[model samples]
Each structure stands twice: as C-alpha cells, then as structure tokens.
Target: MRIKNSTVVITGADSGIGRATALRFAKKGARVVLASRDAAALETLAADCRRRGAKALAVQTDVADPEAVEELCESAVGNFGRIDIWVNNAGTGVFGPFLDTPLEDIQRVVDVDLMGVVHGAREALEQMRAQGEGVLINVASMAGIIPQPYTSAYSMSKAAVRALGVSLRSELRLARVKDIHVVTVSPGAVDTPFFDHVANYTGQDTRPIPPTYSPDKIAAAIVNVARSPQRELTVGLIPKAMVAKHKLFPQAVERRMATLTHRKHLKATQPAPPTKGNLDRAAGDDATGRRGRKTGGHGGRTKTMARRLLVIGGAAGVTAFAAFRWRQ
Candidate 1:
C-alpha cells in the first residue's frame, strides 16, 4: 500500500515510538491522526505534522475504554474520510514480583497492553472490512517471546499481544479480507519513555540500559512493516537471537532465566513516591515533548541484570549451536 495520502491512526502518539511514527508517516504525505489521553501533546504533534505539510488531527483517546476507542476511530474516519491504517501503540508496564505486584497494577497493564490492542483491532477491522482494505500494527516487545523474571505482568501482556496478532492475521485472511494486513513489531530495549513510566514496586528512578536504539529506528521499521506487511518482525539482533534460542532450547532458556533471577541483587529500599504522568495519564501530562525519565527501582534492577545475563547466555548458546551445525 502506498503511504502517500493514506489515512493512518496511531494510538499513544503523544511521545516515544508512536510520536516518532506519526511524524514519519505524516512526512510521507499520509493523513495522520494522533490519539492519546494527552490532548495537549496530541495537539502539539498535530501542529508539527501540519507544519510538515501533511493533513493531521489530534484525537484524545484512552484505548482501554472501548467507547473511547470507538470514538477515536469515528473521529479519524470523520476527519480523513477513511481509515487506511490503525497502529495500536498505546501501552504501559508494571515491574515487580508477580506475587507482590498489586492486582490493580496487573489489571491496568493487561487492560492497556492486551485489551487495548483488542479494541483497536476490532474497530479497525470493522471499518477496514467496509472499505475492503487497511493495516493494523501492534507494537509488542521482546518480552513477548521471552518471559522476564521481575516483570511477569508485562511479559504476560506482551505474550498475549503476540498471540492476538497471529490469531487476527489468520482470522482476517479467513474472512477473505486480503487487503487488510495485521503485523506485529517486536522492539528490544529502545530509548523510550516506557521505562520512566513503568510502575515500579521498589522505589527508585528509571535508568537506561547500556545499549538502546532511538525511537526513530523503531519508527522506520514500523513504516517498512506498514508498506510491506509481515506477520511478525523482531527488531535488534540480540532480541532476534534470543527468540531463536528460546524456540530451539526452551528448557535451556528457562534454566538460564532461572539462574539469572537467583543471582540478582535486590535490596529492600523505600519505594519512591508513586509518580503521576504515566502513559495512562492524559496527553497534557507529557507536555515536555520528550521521553519521560526512566526510573531505577528494585524491580528494574533485577530485570536489567537478568537481561544482561540473557545476552551473555544467548550469545554462548548461539555460538555452540553454530559450531554443532558446522560439524554436522
């Protein structure tokens, strides 16, 4: 599908990957709608898009609310006359031991990550079915393929998203809607506000991983996926290797994760005052027009350590596997 003049609606477009993607598409001459709870941020993004000479609209939306999602789609269609692409990018994460994590926090993560995607797909499919063409892009994470120790809720939500994307792709095909495409974009540790906004059980500020890609890299990949829909695309070489290793040696992968978790250093630190302006907040909350500062907490530290171990183990596993294959 040609990007120029296409109507695309992006949820969570106030900042981060969604914001980057919105700008990318708008620059390509696509009619773009920026949707999020932050009306002010959405307006800012829309203005920027307009300045770039692309038609744009800002729709204040809470994807967890089915009614809000419905209105979002309606507003997009009302403004653009049709929906060509729907990118379900709005999401939130909570990090803590599954047993210790608040049920409310878990439910909130599930609501935004999993159910939100469901709502976006439902609305986009209905409208696309009518037009006989469209695209749906679900932003999943590397955690979708590999379960993380301290971030069980987040892992579960992403895993569900992966399943949802696969199931929806098949269902759309069965319905004979060949023109409509469903693609999942799995990104590794990207430099986004996701970490800063993640709910942390242990009180600490968010920190960055040693190596992280900018949102622009992810936006570029999403644009490519929209142009040529693939069932799933994994970004980053390390993440791709981890996914492959898990598939070939599930037991070994599980054992590696267990070992890393057991060795993680966790201190009983005072929880930081719960911060406002998470992804769940309205767009105006992110008025800085920048990715939120990442927080480093007990949960975040454990997960970070685990990821480092996984990289080392995954690399070793790959090397061994390659040698074995060569010998064979």
Candidate 2:
C-alpha cells in the first residue's frame, strides 16, 4: 500500500520505535493515529505528526486493555473512516531471572508485549474486515528468536509476539483475506528508551546488549514493510546473524548470550532496587525519552567473548563437524 494518504494507527506512539514509526508514516502523507497509556506524550507526538503534514489523532490507551484497543480502533475509524495500516508497537519488559522475578511482573510483560500485540491484531483485523483490506505490522524482537540469558519474561513475551503474527497470517490466508497483511518486525537491541523503561530486578542499572541499532532503522523497516508487506522482517545485520546463528548453532549462540548478558547487561551498571516500570500503570517522566543512553562501544570485547564462548562451549566443533558432513 502507498504511504501517501493511507491511514495508519500506531500503538505506543509516545516513544521508542513507535514514536519513530509515527513520524515516518506521517511524513509519507499518511494520517496517523497515536495510542499509548501516556496521554501527554501522545499529544506531543500528535502535534509532531501534524507538523509533518499529516492529520493526527492521539488516543490515550493501554493496549493490554482489550477495551482500550477496541476504543482506539473505533476512534480511528470514527475519525478517519478506515484504517489502512495498524502497527502494533506497544511493548514492555521485565528483565531478571525468571524464578526471581515476581509473577505479577511476568504477567505484565505478557500483557503488554504478547497479548498487547494479539489485541491490536484482533482489533485491526476487525476494522480491515470492514474495509476488506489493511496491514498489521507487529514490532517483535530478535530476542524472541533467540534466548536472552537473564530477561526470560521479556524474551518469552517477544517469542509469543512472533508466533501470534505468524498464526494470524495463516488464518487470514485460509480465510482468503489476501489483501489484509500481517507483518512481524524483529530488531536486535535498539538504541531507544525501551531499555530505560523495562522492569528491572537484576539489582543493577539496565543496559542494552551490544550491537544496537537506532530506532530509525526499525522505523524504516516498518514503513518499508507497509509499502510491501512481508511475513517477517528482521532489522540490523547483527539481528539477522543472531537469528541465523540460533537456527544453525543454538547451543553456541545460547552460550554467547549467557556470557554477555552477564557481563554486558547485568553487571555492567550500578545496583538498583527492583521496579515494575510502566507495566502496571503509566510510565513516569523518566520514560519520556525516545533514545537509549548506551552507545555500546565495547563491540571488540563482546566479539572476543563470543569466540571464547563458542570454543569453550564446544559449539565451534559442532559447527565444523556439521559443515564437514554437509561437504561429504
């Protein structure tokens, strides 16, 4: 679908990838509908979108609430007539050992990250049915495809998000809704306030793992996907490599992730008390920023650690043996 004159609804438009995507679509001449729990932030983004030469609406919403998502769709169609594209970018995270993390926090993660996507997809599909066509872009994570060592709740939620999109697409295909597209975007650690907002229980200041990309990278993918929908879109070279590595050398990649998530994520920052973040309610002013603080200047050390982990974890030999067998 052409971005110009298309109506696009983006959840979590207050910050991070959602914010970037909202601006991107707006600049492309699409009418933008912004949804998030932060009313003030959404309003600000709405103003920005208007400045970008697109009609904009800011709908304060918690995507975890099916009612709120329903209202969002109603508002969009009520205002714009129909939604041409819906980007399910609303997400939250809880970063800690699965066993140590509170059940509530885990539930919150699922509510926002996985079920949030489900709610948006369902609502979008309903609206698309009315129009007979639409696009659903879900922002998943590379961690969804591979295990992150410490953030089990977040990792699991993302994995479920991917599954949700894939399953929905298959159902849509069977139903012959060929023009209604469901697209999943998987990006590695991105330089966005997403890290600053996750519920933290590791007793340390959170840091995004290495090989981070800017939010614009993911936003561009979203816009591009809207132009021509694909089943799965992975952003960043490292993210693509990580997914491939996980597919062909799961043990090796798991070991590497374990080692780095310890040194690079958990132990790299100062200690802090556990918090539920924005999962339970609206995020604080601290979550207002769009970009992450970490520049991740330690790529060399991470690469070295990855090599050492592969050798020590015995996966290097496994890869070589598999290659040899394939050649034979």
Candidate 3:
C-alpha cells in the first residue's frame, strides 16, 4: 500500500531495529505510534518523527502485559483514527546455556520474543479485520532457523515466531482475508543493542556473531515489505547462505556448530556477571536510539581451525550434498 498518510504502529520503538523502522516509516509521511517500556526514549523518538513532518504519538507499553498492549492499540487508534501497519518488533533475549539459565529468565524471553509477537499480531489483526486491510511485520532472527547451541530460549522463541506468521497466513487465507498480510522477516546477526542487553551466563561479554548487518538495512526491508508483502524474507546474503547450508547438511552442520565455535557465538573479551539484563526491566537511560556501539568481536570468516581435517573426514558424509560441499 502507499505509505503517505498511512497509520503505522511500532512496538519496541525506543531503540535498535524498532527505532530505525519507525524513523524510516515516518520519513515516508506515515503517522507513527511508538510503543515500548521506555517512555522517555519514546518521547524523544516521537519528537524526531514530528520534526520530519509525520504525526507521532508515544505510548509506553510493555508487550508482555496483554492489557498494556491492548491499551497501546487503543491509544494508536484514538490518536490516529486507523491502523494500516503494525510492526511487532518488541523483543528481548537470554544468551546462556539452558541448564545454567534461570527459569524466570527463560519465561521472560518467551513472553517478550514469542508472546509479544502474538499480542501485537492479535491486536493488529483485530483492527485490520474490521477495516478489511492491514499489514503485520514480525521480526524473527536467524537463530530460529540455524539454531544456536547456547541461547536455547531465544532460539525457541524465534522459531515459534516464524511458525506464528506461517499459521496466521494460513488462517487468514482460509477465511478469505487476502487483504490482511502477515510477513515474517528473518535477519542475520545485526548491529543492535540486543547483545548488550541480553541476559548473559556465558561468563564472557557477548557480541553479535561475525557478518553483522546494520539495523537501518533491516528497517528498509520492513518498509519495503509493507508496500509489497511477501511470505518470508531472509535479510542478509551471508545468513541466506548459512540457512541453505544448514538445510542441506543438518547433521554435519550440527556437528560443526557443536564443535568449538566460541568465536561464532561470542568474543573472548571481558567477562560480564550473570544478570537479567533487560528481560524484566527497561534498559535504563541508554536505551533511546537505534545503532549500538560497535563490538571488537570476530570480524573475519568463521573458518574452521582444522579446516582440512574436518572437510576430509566428512567428505563422504557430505558428498551427497553437492551444493553444500565445503572446500579450503
């Protein structure tokens, strides 16, 4: 649909990908509603959007609270008449081994990442079904598909997120609601505050894996999808290839991931204490904007240390998978 004068609501709008997506849409003449637990930051972002000539409202909302999310939807419509696009971007993570991670932390991750998407989608779909047209964009991660070993909760949440979109699409089609579109975007490791805010138990400061892409690129893809919605999108090139390889050689890839891929998941930098970073509370004062501080983490290829030996030993196992055959 056309962007100008459209009404859009974005959750988790205070920082990171949500903020970037809000700004991108606002610049296109869309009235934007900002939602997150950080009211101060949302106010700042609303002012920024207003300066860009878009009608803006800041509504502090915690997606985990069903009532708060419903209130968010009412506030958006009360201020702006109708909802044309809803971006379900509010999310948090826990980066630790399952056994070591606290149960509360795991539950919070599900509440924010998976259930949060469910709430946004439900509210948006209700509004959209009434109007007979709307767009819903859910931001899932590459971890959902590839499956990271350490961050089990986050991986499960994201995977369920993908499933949610697929099921929603099927249900909508069955009901003949073709105008309402549900799009799922799977992004690669992104340069966002997520790594900084994740509940870490790995004993070392966590960082996004190598081949990180900017949040702005993701925001752009989301805006594009709003105009021309597709079934699913894998944002970055490296992530696309990774997904392909994993599908072609599941056992081999699982073995590779299980092997010492510490560099792939984290940096050998300073250690951080075990804390529920942003799972329960809003990230304090520093959560106002998109784009996070660059990490000095892995910047090169995730080349195996013993590349020759692994490839040679697994040659027969992977020979059937010609497309995924690894080479030196």
Candidate 4:
C-alpha cells in the first residue's frame, strides 16, 4: 500500500517504538494521528511529524478504556476522513516474582497490554471494514513466545495478543475479507522506555535482557509490514532464533530464560524501591531517554551471555535450521 497521503493512527506515540514509527510514517508522507495517556508528549511528537512535512494530530487516549479508544478512532476519521493504518503500540509491564507482585499491578498490565490491543483492533477493524482496506498492527513481544520469569502477567498478556492475531486472521479468512489485515510484531528486548516505566517489585532495578535491538529496528519492520502485510513479524535475529528454539525445546528454553531473568535482567548492583511505575499514569518524558541510554549498554559480557544461552538452550542439531526456516 502507498504510504504517501495515507492516514495512520499510532497509540503509545509518546516514546519507544511507537514514537519512532510515527516519525517513520510521517517521513513516508503519511498523515499521522498520535495517541497516548501523555498528551504533552503526543503533541510534541505530532509537531515533530508536522515539521517533517506531514499532517499530524494528537489525541490523549488511554487504550485500556474502550470508550477512549473508540473516541480515538472517531477523532482519526473526523480529522482524516479515513483510517489507513492503526498501530496498537501502547504497552506496560510488571516485573517481579508472581507472588510478590501486586494483583492490581498484574491486572493493570493485562488491561493495558492485552485488552488495549483488543480494544484497538476492534475499533480499527470497524473503520477498516467500512473503508474496505487497512492494516492493524499489534506490538507484542518475544515474551509472548518464550516465557520470561518474573513477568508472569506480562508474558501471559503478550501470548494472548499473539493468539488474538491468529484468531482475527482466521475469522477474516473465513469471511473472505482480504483487504483488511491484522499483523503482530514481536520484538526482542527493545531499547525503549519499556524498562524504565515498568512496575518493578524486585529490590533491584529492572533492565532489558541482553541483545536488545533499537526501537528503530522494530519501526523499520513495522513499516515493511505495512507495505506488505504479514501475519506476524519478529524483530531481532536472536529473538527469532529463540522463538524457534522454544518451539523445539520449550522446557529447556523456559528454564534458561528463567535463569537469565533472575540474574542478568535485573540489576543487582542497582537497588530500587518499588513503585507503580506508570501503570495508572504516564512516566516523565525523560523516561524514554536517548538511544545510548535505552539499552544502558549491554556490553560484551551480556552479548557473550546471550550467545552462550543460545548455544546451551537450543537443540544443537536443529537450532540453525529452525532459525533459518523461521526467517524464510
């Protein structure tokens, strides 16, 4: 589909992959509608897009609220006349032992991560069906495919999101609706405010796991998927490999991932007090950070750790083939 002059709506436009994606679509000449709980950030991003020579609108929205999401859709149509692409990029996480994490925090994660996507998809599909063509992108995570310890709710929500995509596609196919598409984007640990804003119950500060990719990488994949709709896209090579390995050795991969989550994923040296990190509210603008701060520089040691995990956790014989085939 031609991006130029297309109307695209992106949720979570305040930061991370969503922010990058909004800019990308704008540069491609698409009119962008930005949504987030952070109205100030959304407006700032919208202005940036406008400066890039594309029309932009900012809508303050809480995706967990169905009414608000519906209004977001209405706002898009009211302004642009039609919706060409809708991206459900807003997400939050809760990190800590399952028992230690607050039940309310877990519920909030599911509400924002899983139900948020469902709300967006439902609203976007409504507009798409009427318009006769559109792309609905849901930003899930590798955690959906491979469970990450200390993130039971996050993992469960993401897995549900993946299943939502599959079920939507099946329904679309059975109904012979070919133009409207549902695409799921699963990225590895991305360099985003995700870690910064995640509710952490652990005594240690939380960080992205090793081998994290830039949000731009995921943004690029999102644009590519928009151009040529696919059922799903996983962003990084390591994540793709991990997903494939998980399919073959679920128990082994889960155990290894759990170990990694306990050790490397949390910063033992950096003690942090527990806070309800942006679950009920928005984080400060600085939470997004510059590119350099995003991954906090995983360094050689973490990279080596990632590689070793792959080597030990994957089935030696089929690992390479599975990873290769997954990409194809």
Candidate 5:
C-alpha cells in the first residue's frame, strides 16, 4: 500500500523505536498520531512531524488501559478521517530472576508489554475491519523466540505477543479479510532506552545484548512492512539466523542463548539498585541520569558484531539446510 497520505498511529512515540518510526512515517507524508504516557514529549514529536509537513496529533495514552486505547483510535479517526496503519510499539520490561523479581513488577511488565499490545491491536483491528483495509504491526522481540533466562516475564510477554499475531492472522484468513493485514516484527537487540528504563532486580546494571542495531533500523523495517505487509518479520540478519538455528536445535540454542545473556546482557561489574523502571508510569528524562539520551546503551562494537554475526549466521544457515536435505 502506498504510504503517502496514509493515516498512521504509533504508540510509545516519546522515544526509541516508536519515536523513530513516527518520524519515518512523517517523512513519507503519512498523517501521524503519536501516543505515549509522556504528553509533553508526544506534543514535541507532533510538532516535529508537522514541521516536516505531515498532519500530526499527540495523544497521551497508556496502552494498558483499553479505554484509553479506544480513545486513541477515536482521536485518530476524528482527526484523519481513517486509519491506514497502526503500530503497536508501546512496551516495557523486567529483568531479574523470576523468584527475585517483585510480583508487582512482573504483573506490570505483562500489563504494559503484553496487554498494551493487546489493547492497541484490538482497537486498531476493529477500526480496520470497519474500513475493510488496514495494517497492524506488532513489535515483538528475539527474546520471545530464543528465551532469555533472567528476564522470564519480559520473554513470556513477548512470546505471547508473537502468538497473538499468529492467531490474528489465522482469524483474518478464515474470515476472508484479504485487505486487512497483521504483521509481527521480531527485532534483535536494539539501541534504545529500553535497557535504561527496564525494571532491574538483578543487583547489576542492564544493557542490550550485543550486535545492537539502531532504533532507526527497526523503524525503517516497520515502515517497510506497512507498505508491504507480511505475516511475520525477523528484522535483523543476526536475529533471522538465530531464529532459524533455534528452529533446528531448540535445546542447544536455548542453552547457548541463556549463557550469552548471563555473560553479556547484564553488567555485574556495574552494580545498580533495583527500581521499577517505566513499567507503571512514564520515566521521562530524569529516569536515567542521562536525561536527554534516547539510545546507546550498547557498546560501540555494533558494526563489528553485526559483521561477525552475519558470517556465522550464513555458515550456520548453509550447514543446517544441507544437513536437513541429506536426511530427507
């Protein structure tokens, strides 16, 4: 579908991937509606989009609240006349041993990460079904596929999101809703404020896993998917290969991922106190001491790590395919 003049709504638009995606859509001449718990930030983003010559509206929303999400949809239609694309990008996470993590924090993660997607998708689908044509993009994560040991809640919520996309597609197919589409995007570790805003109980500082791609990269993927919808998309090359490997060797890959997450995802040397980071409310600039920093939690080895992962993934993909063919 053409993006120019398309009406698009993006949640979690205050910063990170959502923020980037909103800007990309704006640049493409799409009418954009920005949603987030941070009203001021959303207004700023809306102004930025308008400056770029796109119609934009800032709606302060907590995606966990179904009513608020419903209002968000109404606002979009009232302003733009129709909904063409809805990106369910609002999410939060918790990182700690399941037993050590606070129960409330676990619930909050589900509320924001899982239920938030649920609310956005539900509201958007209803609007799309009425219009008979639209796209719904749900942002899941690699953790949903390869299991992270410490972040049980976060992983579970993301896994559920992946399942939700599958179920929605099946339902749409059965109903012969050909024009309406549901797309799931599973992104690899990304350079976003997510690590900084995560609820951490590990008694250590958190960081994104290696080979972290910039939020802009993921934003581009989301925008591309909106133009040409697909049932599912693994955004990064490394994540795509790891997903394939997991399909062939779930147990081995799961074990290796668990080990890597322990060694690299969390920084034991950098001790930090536990806090409920952005799970319940919007953790604005003051949440992390670096007030204006939007991304860059990962180290500076992104390009190098990506190259290494690509080589390893290519070799693994060839070997795996060859082995399967030999058995057949």
Candidate 6:
C-alpha cells in the first residue's frame, strides 16, 4: 500500500517505537494520529510531525480502555476522513520469578501489552471493513518467539500477540478482505525507556538494562511492513537466529537456556528501594503516584553473575549454530 497521503493511527506514540514510527510516517507524507495516555508528550510528537510538513493530531488515549480506543478511531476518522493504518505499539513489561511477581503487575502487563493490541485491532477492523482498505500492525518482540527467564508475563503477552496476528490474518483472508492487512513486527531488545518502566519482582532497587538496538531500526522495519505487508518480520540478527534455532533445535535451545538459568539469583532476599524514571512516569501516567520513586530492592551479586553467564552461554550457542548453518 502506498504510504503517501494515508492516515495512520499509532498507539503509544509518546515515545520509543511508536513515536519513531509516527515521525517516520509523517516524514513519508502520511497524515498521522499519535495516541497515548500522555497528553503533553503526544502534543510534542504531533507538533514535530507538523514541523516536518505533515498533517498530525495528538489523541490522548489509554489503549487498554475499549471506549478510549473507539474514541481514538472516531477522532482519527472524523479528522482525517479515513483510517489507513492502525499500529498497536503501546506496551509495558514486568520482570521477576512468576511466583514472586505481583498479580497486579501481571494483570497490568497483560491488559496493556495483549488486550491493548486486541482493542486497537478490533477498532481498526471495524473502521477498515467499512473503508475496505487498511493495515493493522502489531508490535511484538523476540520474547514472543523465545520466552526468557524472569520475564514470563511479558513473554506470554507477546506470544499471545503473535498468535493474534496470525489468527487475524487468516480470518481477514477468509472474509475476503484483501485490502485489510495484518502484520506483526518482532523486535529484539531496543534502546527505549522500557527497562526503566519494567516492574521488578526480584525486589531489586534497579534493573539491569540489556544490549539494545535503536528504536529507529525497528521503526524502519514497521514502515517497510506497512508498504509491503508480510506475515512477520523479525528484527536483529541474534533474535532472528534464536527464533530459527528454536524452530530447528528446540531441545538444544531449551537445554542451553536451562543450563544458563541463574537459580541463585532468583533468591533476591533483600528488598531494596523501588526504581524510578520509567517511561510510564515520563509519559505522565504515574496515576499510582509511584513515579520517580525507587520501587525497592538492593543489587544481587548472584543475579549479575547469572546474567553474565547467560550472555556468554547464549553467545557461544549462537556462534556454534551459525557456523553449522554456514557449513550447510
């Protein structure tokens, strides 16, 4: 589909992948509607888009809310006359042992990361069916394909998103809606404020940030998907390899992950102060008043040790697999 002159609605547009995508689309000559719970940030992004000579609107929306999503769709169609693309990019993460993680945190993550995508797709489909031409882009993650230790809830949510995309794509085809496209983009670790916002179950005062790719890298992939719809697009070499390895050698991957697991780190006994400066708070969604305050927990020597071991192990596994594939 041609991106020029199309009207697109992007959730989580306050920052990160969503914000980058909004800017990219606007720069590509598409009218963009930036939606997120953060009114101020949304306004700033929209203004930036306008500065780039593109028509833009900021809609303060909590995608987890069904009514809010409907309103978002209405506002976009009302203002722009049609909806061409709907991007479900708003998401959050919580890390720690599944048993130790707060139920509230789990529910929140599922609601935002999974149900939020569902709501966006439902609203987009309703409008797109009428127009007979639209694109639904769901932003998943590498975790969706290969579940990681200590991030069970996030992994589950992303896996569900991948399933949702596949199901929706087939349903759309069966319904004979050739113009309505459903695409999923799975990105690896990205340089976003995601780590800052992540709920920690380990009770650590601060969480360690992982190696990351730029948000612009994923944004470029999303633009490509919109232009030429695909079933799925995996971002990053490591993540792509992990997905392929999991498919080809599930047992080997499972053995490696288990061997790399940090059992000692899982026992974070001392609760430190909670962390602060998460993107959620930055976006002004600190409704719980927990913004800018540490959540709690001291650093765990064992946890750090475990992370290092996993990194080394993962690298070794990837190298071995790559060599084998090259030889083949």
**Candidate achieving the largest lDDT:** 4
Q: What TM-score does prediction 6 earn?
A: 0.82
| Stretches of candidate 4 exceeding 4 Å from the true structure | 287-294, 298-328
Estimate, for each residue in 71-96, the C-alpha lDDT of model 1 and write its tens digit.
99999889889999899998887766
lDDT of candidate 4 over 1-328, digit per residue (tens): 7799999999988888899999999999999999999888888888989999999999999999999999999999999999999999999998889999999999999999999999999999999999899999999999999888889999999999999999999999999999999999999887777777778999898877777777777898999899999999987667776776777779998999999988878888999899888899987765334243536675212446567566456545466766777899
**Clashes per candidate, residues 3 or more apart or on different chains:** 10, 0, 0, 0, 0, 12
Per-residue lDDT over 284-303 for candidate 3, one digit per residue giving the tens place of the 0 to 100 score? 78788465554444322333
lDDT of 5: 0.86
Candidate No. with top TM-score: 5
Candidate 6 regions exceeding 4 Å error are 205-210, 255-282, 285-328
- Per-residue accuracy of model 2 over 262-324 as CA lDDT, tens digit each: 888775457888888767777657455667655455322333557556544554555676688
C-alpha lDDT values of all predictions: 0.79, 0.83, 0.85, 0.87, 0.86, 0.78
Order of models, best lDDT first: 4, 5, 3, 2, 1, 6
Clashes of 5: 0
lDDT winner between 1 and 4, please give it: 4
True-structure RMSD, every candidate: 4.7, 4.3, 5.1, 3.8, 2.5, 6.3
* TM-score, cand. 2 vs. native: 0.90
lDDT over C-alpha atoms for residue 16 of model 1: 86
lDDT of 5 by residue, 102-186 (tens): 9998888889889999999988999999999999999999998887988998899999999999999999999999999999999
Could you tell me the lDDT of residue 137 within candidate 2?
92
- Pairs clashing within candidate 5: none
